[model samples]
Target: MLVYSDDYLEVIHRPASSSCILVTFNEMEMQANGSRFWGQRFCEKADFAALGFISRRPNWFPAASIEKAAAATAAILRQASERILYGHSQGGYAALRYRLLLNADVAIAFCPQLSIDPAAVPFDGRFTRHFAPALHADMEIMPEHAAGRAYVFYDPFHAVDRMHAEWIAEKQRETRLLPVHMTGHGTVRAFAGTARGLALIESCRADDVPGLRALARSVRTGAAMRPYQVALTAIARHPAWADRLSARFGNGFSSVERVNFLYHRANRHIRDGELATARDLLVEAMALQPNNLGPARRLQELDARIVRTSRT
Candidate 1:
């Protein structure tokens, strides 16, 4: 049911008889101005009250109406015996930001950024445009003040993400930094790719950190994780493993996986000065996922470069 809607936010609430509540935030989608209730389809089988917040823009937990919403969320959470906050990427940031405000018992954040302010994280340029208006916002305090536990999942090899995780760990003693190697910034994808995401979520709800760790390790070694590792290896400029992986597995990849593999290969070819090969791989990627603007934009750039080279 719709709980709140304004120019800045849209909230949806699904009530259940269970004593537990799962509060979630939505991730930013390409070209989309607003967000939706994330994880509804996945959590349909579970017996918990679900509350999701959707931002109307690519704004962080906007300070404008967060307090009002937090009060309402806290009121709901007070009725439940247990509460968990869950999100990934931009939403992950929100889960952490509001965890203490809602008095959530547990928070599971996948690749969350602690702060986008240049004063705090001047090195990260990935979200410079989004960070511009939020610079003056106070980021000194986080969910660290809460007595509840927080689990942060991120790829240690992802330099920027690693930096953010490390900073968060240093600031918050209640938070645990779990390193998911070679999973890239999309750590949640790594969990879902292997079908172990729900298991991890359940484990976190049970407050079983060891079980969560063991489950994560098992997923890392499973067949489903191979495609993700292969993509990461190729993106890191080592395509030999990607070739070996494809040869062994054959054409068993999903469309999204195929598109990512092709894009990575295109990047490798471009670095090797094989523009034609890069162009062909990118074309294949575009064919697999035509609506994806990332490859579409990159393909246009490649076309312009090829035309310039031909004229010369």
Candidate 2:
């Protein structure tokens, strides 16, 4: 059922026999194909009723305001005995940001930012372009905004995500930070469809903090990002091993991962004083992902270094 629809946001309701309601928020749409509910499939599988908050763009759910967003669906939300908010990235931000407003019992956020506002989180410029002052004037996810318990799942090794998780934990004493290491910014992907992922979700639903800690302790070695981390580590120590791994699993790597692998390997070569090799690797990476500014910028820097070395 369509609960609410606007230019920027859409709310879809899936009523179940259960008293519990899981409200899901949509992540930033990579392609922006109309409005989409984030966890529709998951909701269909679950016994609980669900409300999916879909964003039209990557505006970070600032279509109107948090108050207005809440008001739009207050009647529907009020019907539920237990409300659990869940989402990843921008959606994750919404889950935490609107917890209190939605009267949620639990919020499960994956790699959610404290704020994309440059003024608030100057260290993280990744989502700055998406930040609009008119819409996101007050983008910070404060302590008081959260209700009941909030579980934040993020990669501690990912510096920006780590900082956000730490800040959220520090501000909200009840918020639990579960570090899913080596998954990078895409921590949610590590547990998607796997037995471990099911266990993590069940633990969150049950509010089992000890189980979550134990699951975290098991660690993630087979995650999608683990290969990239392993490849990068191998590149730094055993170049031959890196080459062998690439030969074995290169086909499985996504274009983004391939580009990243090449970029990091180039950096390793530059550190080893192999500028020409670094340039070749970077050129290959550029060919793979031309739109990526990191490799393009590095290529320019490498050329400048090459020129300076020649002059010297």
Clashing pairs in 1: none
What is each predicted model's overall lDDT from 0 to 1?
0.74, 0.82
- Tens digit of lDDT per residue, candidate 1, span 13-124? 7888877888887777622233347776555656558888777666665755667777666667788888888888777887777777778788888888877777778878
* Winner by lDDT: 2
Candidate no. 1 TM-score: 0.78
lDDT of 1 at 4: 69
Lowest summed lDDT across 10 adjacent residues in model 1 is found at: 27-36
Off by over 4 Å in 1: 30-36, 129-136, 139-147, 189-202, 223-225, 235-237, 246-259, 273-276, 283-312
Q: Per-residue lDDT for 178-215 in model 2, tens only?
A: 98777877887776754664577678878899999788
- Candidate 2 achieves a global lDDT of 0.82
